[model samples]
Target: MRHFSSSATRTSRHRVIGALTAALLCAAGATVPAAAHSPATPAPPAGAPAGSGLALTPPMGFNNWNSTHCRAEFNESMVKGIADIFVEKGLKEAGYEYVNLDDCWAKTQRNADGKLEADPVRFPNGIKAVADYVHSKGLKLGIYTSAGTRTCDSVGIPGALGHEFSDAQQFADWGVDYLKYDNCNNLGVDAKERYTTMRDALAATGRPIVYSICEWGENKPWEWAAELGNLWRTTGDINDSWNSMLSIMKQNLPLAAAAGPGHWNDPDMLEVGNGGMTDTEYRTHFSMWSVMAAPLLIGADLRKATPETFDILSNHEVIAVDQDPLGKQGTVLSSDGGRWVVAKEMQDGSRAVALFNETGSAQRISTTATEAGLPEATAYSVRDLWTHTTTNTAGGLSATVPAHGTVLLRVAADKHWAAYPPAVELALDGSALVEAGRTAKLTTRVTDLGRTPATKVSAALTGPAGWQVRADSATTAAALATGRTLATRWQVTAPAGTATGTYDLTLTTRYRAPSGKQVRSSVPFQAHVVVAPPAGGGYLSDLPRLSASNGYGPVEKDTSNGESAAGDGKPLTIGGQVFTKGLGAHASSSVEYYAGGACSTVTASVGVDDETGAKGSVAFEIWSDGTKAASTGVLTNDMAAQSVSADVSGAQVVRLVVTDGGDGVDYDHADWGDLRITC
Candidate 1:
């Protein structure tokens, strides 16, 4: 029963037609109540625990969301089987509890007594029977409902809306140990008020059920859910994919302050073993969730879970970080777009650090103990959580993380070494601009921040395929003194027949720490390498290879104003004609081209791109060696193409300038099509 915002497109939905049909028919035969049964004021039974106090740590359990999604296959037998497997497979012993159900279990309508009932087909023995069975196994039972008038998957069952008290009492009477309250079909009710009502209702029931608020963070539950529920979902539903998981993680990283003991900020349920991600990616997902102190709710089918799934889910080392007594959610200390270092402070003063690589290739990620809150220059015993290996070191730690993976380590201060790792900072220059068939010199500066000399320094460059990238300086050098900067340079030559496109280059540097251990760090740099296209043939995206200038708005490339994509994916279009580049911005945008005396006559079709409507005026000017050769009077943003030519017979350079015609630039998308220079 997952729902996305209106701005988002739904990629998939839970297919539970059979369950909905049965529930709907049952509701059709049941009676409808005229009024909701709500108490005038919510008053909890004596000795009821506060919502925040219910979950002292992020709850470790399993939910049916990702696996079944309330499909017809989700029934009493399936749930009981999961509970039995949890106990039999030692998951229960490993602290995995709470067999939870999502939506679609309830009938469409309430009984004559205004009590919601379970669908006979899916739960013939009713919810209480299932709860009692779960209790017999020493486990807990969880149920789901919506905060809105109808659930997200309201094909059959209605929502709690005005029946908060009655529903909470029913759950308590049925011995439900947990409730996953959703926000679907809320009918515009204020999220805070509606969720607060449920919180009070659960409290009044005198039951110690774990309350999970699922509003998809629309109303910012973390800002106010501290007293509203034990845990709160802080993002939309998670899909079983790498991008979805990473997006959720990115959104949750900044909300760590809103989480702690009792009130955990949940980033949806886990998707490990769901067959949508690789084992390495699953490990990254699990480790990140644990590091962030998010509730560990496995959403895979335990009945068919692979051994790898069990291994990742049962890793006690990672789990301990999630359940640390300090209750501090980890913080992202540093990130380079794809690589990140997240550190959590433990109660024992040791810090748990996760070196994460979100890229598609393995990368060396490193961080200092000081940056992660560990004492600087102090010897520490490092424990690799994934491998369970221990090492003693006083310097910083580095590890090669697999693609979409993490290196989780627990650091405890030791007194063995008096030395520290050389603090190294890496910098690169001339990584943004490159031309084909030419060798570009890239300069790298590495500085040592520690008093100890960094020994055996080396650097290497990895460029695109078919490209030759080599270091001009000696790859290996003698020890570098403290506070000294080692300037390493590399020359990269693009192939003579290389294609025109942006390429990624990686620079890796290795140096020995003060502890005499080799450490490595990598930084990614982009190279916009361009090769001249055949006469009259060029891509709009490649226009940056020449020169572009803007006085007000951005220089649009091969695209309409305000859009990232070209109007029809064409390469050339101008004032309205065909051109190689579609450059546009607000006030003034211009481009310059000098083909090294390759052409004497510059011809182009200029006009506004068809996609841009009439909004502003732009005048095009052609200059040769600082002299005006031709000018296209002012042209408005209309879908019409105009032909313009300028003779640069003996000019050394040719320039094209577009300016807003005396007025502010708004919706001004100018294009140059079929531009060419002929000698």
Candidate 2:
């Protein structure tokens, strides 16, 4: 239900581009200021009838927006196929129940009777037929429409603004069970009045259709939408990237007081299985959404989803947290640097704790059960949702989470503590970059945190095919007593012709539990394969980066930081100075290039891009190998371009990083202008 224009071609009946652009510009940057609402935001009046009984918890479903996005493949067959996959892939059993259709489902114009009509070619059987099919699968059907004269699709299908009653009646007649009303092309109408009209119209139909207001939190919906819709969006659209997901999460995590049964704060849809992030990141995405009690509407194409995607979607433990009858949104307990600790109260007196690491390196995050709001007890049961393993902890809960990963734990007091396994933690320490044909040594430390000892503990490391991996020291031990650790070292060798990029390795650790069962934990490890650049001076943009991650869109080669769309940037400009060659990136971004141990120095002019108009703040750092070689403490848009030079002799990889300057990443567009490297 995002309010962004799609690439669908418009019909002659639609308004002109100039008019649409004017409307879009008016709605641009409509996000409500943070001061407008907070965790203390009051709830709706009691006995409010809007969405009184529907969506008692956050909705769990699939919306065909992020994946197909009005493409040719987004047809009746695809919707039916998704419903079928819901049933066939255990998603239905896991508590997902809705099959939602997004924009471009309707025709450009209404029918002769002034009623909305489904696209004939895309839905030959009409929406009613698709709704019937979805209902037959024991799932609800959700349809999308804007509150203006046209939908978000560039083709401009009929909206429900003036025809609210008629469209609501038509959807009711079609057996639609959910409605995602978006905000686009509203013609400057008041958001509340526009959405209220549709709400009243839907209620008059005498059906139980769930109303989801997609106003992008422009008017502080959390302060007023609880009495009007079942769920209201609290942020803009979500893209399938870590920074996009993290930024949205930060925006939505502060409005916990506005969410509850039948009324919730929607942070947009799930981006799992979208392929933009690693599986570890997807797990964190799912875990955080569940902890925050956000709608679990999947945004991936189910017909082509991988097994890993299905696994993340169908995790019953995580899903239960999202669907908890308590309906309390998670609140941030602590946040320092890039580490976050969030906790949610469940219906049965349990607390769901998420130790999230947003940094670019592995970190040890810890939180006590008492700090998580659990009552004092002799022992607590710590359940790892992703690993599906339960362990007994005296009081402390901790994990060494990977970069952009989460350790989701459900902590609760348990009387039968001896029945569960002892908690064993794993941590990996070693270099992250290795030259081709060279070897690197990595160490894994296993510790027993439970009261009892873990027997026959062992660890092993495995790399990609054609790469050599072996244990350099003892990998097994008789037993690891409480608070004791066993460290093992492994030697890894990349092939001589290994590609210059990041490679994944798995570190698996196993131990025998008190119940005589084997417990296994597998952690993902990344190693960069570097080959120095050609022995010459050249622009840094000319070389292929080993890895790149931007906060907004893809890092640009030679332009200013633009919007969320790739290749939309202009000439790179900093403090009114334009550069023809540089990297345009957003805050909290990183790009690594293989220096091949040949580059002697790297230089650049770094500053906040003027495109943000004195509204951005960021700090730039250069990392040579694993050490910081140079840094610009903090740069703002008001400052001129500052020169940065880093000594990079014998460095295998050079990394350029830009971080948000203590504040959030709200307009932190940055530019690395005239960057050059000398070898």
Candidate 3:
């Protein structure tokens, strides 16, 4: 579903937005240039610069790729239904205007008249009919095509690579208001020239159309597309996963200076309600996208979206930051201690700050007004956008952010007095299951939830008698700011003769708050230790493991997915450590196992290994005697290894199959670690 950026010259040329704006104004009423061939270009006529005044702000809308992925079910009726949801669900009122058709909307070939035709069966009333419907509903219609001979999806329909003018005219005649021009099968054509040709064609039609260049950031369009397009895709497609979402945000946030006003950097689409991440992560996703001024296109099934999704998508105050008249993308002020702080300069001289906790546990985050680009030591009033609560910050704001969450605030100068004390919370990230008499590691992350910084931060761990916890049971940490996190790991080992059962763990953290007061907090948790069975079988990890004997290829050590392919091999990382011993297979591909039979269950932790967009997308399935027993939901980059189990009693053979999740097999590098069959 994505075409990542290929190798290109690392050019660092920079062009200001004012220059591009001036170029558009200068090109008004100019004659468009003709292309080199029949499909390459069209005759010149009335023209202007590309995408001028069309995307003064990032365009908000709904795209259909993440939801259906060019299935046969995509048709005019589906478009109409989504258009209705745009209005009926109040999305249109929330500023989501464009109802875009991504791919597979056209016929395999042009009609006898040499015109692109809508699929007769799927779009009986034609593209114009759907456009009319969206317009009537007070929304714009967006269509998709490619700069290559075939679209990225290659749905059999020809792309607009060589038919710039003709396709532009057809789209204009159909009343299309936006075009998502993709880059697929382009045969090494210069991306800039190819897209510019269509830009001129659209402008020559004397119609206002938003030109969205979908080069997948391969050519660094952010540096050159300002005058050629309204918005350009800065990365590959986005999937519904926490890792994918956060990775995209991390990549786009650094390119903020490349965005402003009309020319925006698109980070694909939103995956808020796709069930890939928690609601907390969705808020962070929306908050990050808004702060970066990225397009806010919803990519979920709107007809059945939950209220939580609607609330996240329809947050007006957050939307205001995205649509700010200043049109400046936010900048990251700090990214230390698992806390990411972003500050966007508003038109009214105020700053919109987003404090994000990227840890897996709740953390206290704080920053002073000066650190957040506001006047230092000056009284300021803080408004929490999500909570809609206004409070006075003596110098800055602070709050305790949940795991993978964010706190959005609008800070302005005020002569008020309010002091929020620093607070600390602790969370542990490690396996709940531990091997008796063996050593295990657990990471403790402490977060500050007050407005001021906490100093003298240290932690200690205590467990059952005869148990040993090593590696800095008393560890010191750097000063922690509000919303910031400090992580420490402690190794715990039980006595060799200790009983196998659940044991309690206590983590006591001692710290000095901003007020110079010492405080201590205790967190009680549990870890289970299961001893190896005295007889026949144990976890495969305890014994020498064998690779696939059939239905697979070479088994390389430390390889998870595959190599140089969608199912390419990549290593598995757990708790930030690479687990070299595991199983890796491609979709429709399997690894056989003979770890003995008569076992009560087969268990293995599964997930994708790579972080390269959809190439790491896959579903892990376990099969016994040609029948499915256990499977996991589609795992992307963000999802960590999850335990997948199935009954295998009386079984002699079992296999792990990594299949393309009902879609064509692409990035199906599946990982199954600690694979075992136990009685």
Candidate 4:
């Protein structure tokens, strides 16, 4: 629920180089320089209050900002109906307790006595009445206001800046359980002082109200807000898009040590059911947020929510990780290219491992129990939190994750290997690329990692419909000993006229556990069908990209960088020059095109787009195959467009990359003006 205009005054601040830049640069074989500021975990401020004993775990609830905003639908009836749905839909039982009201719930002005008043038309029965109703249902109520003189809404309702004590007293009397104090129109007051004033006011009322500091991390709230609020906003607002969520996750992932049992780092609210992203992406968002120990505030309208939304929100196993008693936030174990491995230590001696794929294509991401910080054991129980399935692993934990998807696993040391299926790791051993209608030799390797030997171990590879798969040799094994692998090669043929794209091939293995129970496990492999592009020369924008990912929003085609929505960009402009064609991308973006080893050169005039004026800086790199073919060291909006020409001859893939220029991604709108590839 953050609102800030482009012209709004804010103290100059820069974000620490987050995981996105570091990981992507590392993957590109670039040395990452040290950040200007220390990346150390910030210690809690001295004498930090222990909080109100509320929200010991990150709060789970619903906020109307993302779904309803300040619309008329967000009235008293809507509020009460949400509370009812929370009970009827089993959300309340699933540990979602708070029914929060966001901005515009109050009148434009304060009452005669300088006390804030709810809008009569919106909350006809008053906030206390709604609070009573929520409490009757065994849930708590939260209300919103800004720490400045006005709220975030355009009309600007009365804020709690100078009226903290009176407002806190009123909230206490009204049984408000949570206070989402925002930052807006602060008149340039010190952030710590403004937030700490409300903390003191809330405490003075002797009411257990959870304080959420919504300063948008402009003041490095994680460094000092721990003592002032239960949770602090770590980034700006989150729109319902893959880039937005992923960017925010990168921003929050580095501050793990600042979070604890009583204090949390809030990356805004959940956008799971908001409809902009696919279910796969939503699951990644939820899983990543849970692993980060962020608050699980449902930001979708529950009344109209689909079953899929509820399913993603009600995943109890993932929720348990968010609500773990130890309250430790997860940190990135490794991130390369678009694959990330994050692990969180649980209170029950388990480790929650999230294998996240942020690319546009499916990828095989792997990690080990030891890498996840699990103590050595004969076997480890790996439970898929999303699929609700438990399997044992000797040490390897891996999965082929779909694009923008996450596989959440809970790994724990287990001695009861006899009761569970033997851990069999399935992997593909050769190149996954095959020309359409051609046969590819796919090798399936299954390794037995359990303590006991497995009998009747068999494997089969199955592709999409109309595709044929035949084992090159015996696919069945009579017996497999511990730590032994059974490898089989299969001739997989794609049907003629098959589309050129990535397709899933399943590798299923059947074996008998020590208990003689037939156990089946299947792992997915991505088969890339490469079709040579027609010989041609054209603007890169007009060519179909193999894959594209932007750091801020979708990559713009022949337009200036715009907001999160696609097709919202303006004319492609760099400095004072406007072009009719090119790609407008944010920093930390990549667009891969199928060159088919035919394109001889890629040329572009690149610089920070004029859309961001003189505020942005970025570097443009053209990668042919896996090697850097051309690069512009760094270009700012004030600089003239720099011409780049990359020799991409014999390169199958040409990737256009924009980096944040080692400062930060803020305002890094890069333009590739008149970009063209010649064949």
**Number of the predicted model whose TM-score against the real structure is largest:** 4
Native RMSD of candidate 2 (Å): 7.9
Candidate 2 C-alpha lDDT tens digits along 1-679: 2211212122211222234332000111111111111212233333344355678878889999988877899999999999999999988877788899999998898888998888999999999999989989988899999888888777868788899989888988998888999887888788888888888887777777788999878788999998789999997778787768977888899999999988999999998998998899999999999899898999999888999999898887788778777889999998765679999998778898999987665666788899999889888778887777778877788888877889988888877776788887777764356677998777878888786779999888889999898888888899988778888887888989887777877778789987898888777767777665777969999987877777777788998767667787788888888989999998778887878778899999999887776588899999997789999988998999999999999887788988888776767888999999998
lDDT of 3 by residue, 1-679 (tens): 2322111111101111111110000111112111112212332344444667667778889988888777877888888999998888777777788899988888888888778999888899999999999989878899998887766553457888788999999998998888999876676778888988998888877677888998867778899998788899887556676645665676588789899877999998999898878898899999989898888888988877899999999887788778776788999988764578899987777788998976543455677777877766445666667865454455545655665789888776644323423545566763233566788777877776545677888888788888888754437776887667777778888877766555777777888755566777665555555454325565553543222321122333455544423334556653344666666554444454442344667787777655344355668777664468888887776776788998876554455666556643434455667666776
The digit string of per-residue lDDT tens for model 1 on 1-679 reads 3221111223333222223210001111212111111112234454333353456778777888799876888899989999998898877776677889888889988899989999999999999999999888877888999886667673857789899999999998998878999876666778888888988888887677788998877667889888678889887678787756875787688899998877889999999999988898899999999899998888998999999999998887787788776789999998763579999998778888999976544455788777888877545656677766455444566665655788887876655323435545455742234567888777776766444677888877798788888777766667877556678777888887666555778777788876778888666555666544346534334443344444322345554444322232334444444454544433345465544344567776776555444455677877775578998988876546777888877664466777666653434456666566665
Residue 60 lDDT in candidate 1:
75
RMSD of each: 12.7, 7.9, 14.5, 7.9
Q: 1-679 in candidate 4: lDDT tens per residue?
A: 2211112222111111112110001111112111111112232333445244556788899999988878899999988899999999878877888899999899998878998888999998899999999989888899998888887676768889899999999998998888999877676778899888888888777667788998888878899988778999998878788877887898899999999877899999999888999999999999999999999999998889999999999877788788887889999999876789999998778899999998776666888999999878777777788877666667888777777889988888866545667677777873366667788787778888666777899998888888888999878998888778899988988888888777888889999887788888887767777666556788989877677888777898999667666787888887789899999898779888877678899999899877775587789999997689999898887898999999999897788998888876788888999999998
Q: Which model, 1 or 2, shows the larger TM-score?
A: 2
* Model 3, TM vs. native: 0.63
Local distance difference test, each candidate? 0.70, 0.81, 0.69, 0.80
Find the number of clashing residue pairs for candidate 2. 2
User: What TM-score number comes out for model 2?
Assistant: 0.83
Better of 3 and 4 by lDDT: 4
Question: What are the runs in model 1 whose C-alpha is more than 4 Å off?
Answer: 1-9, 12-52, 416-679
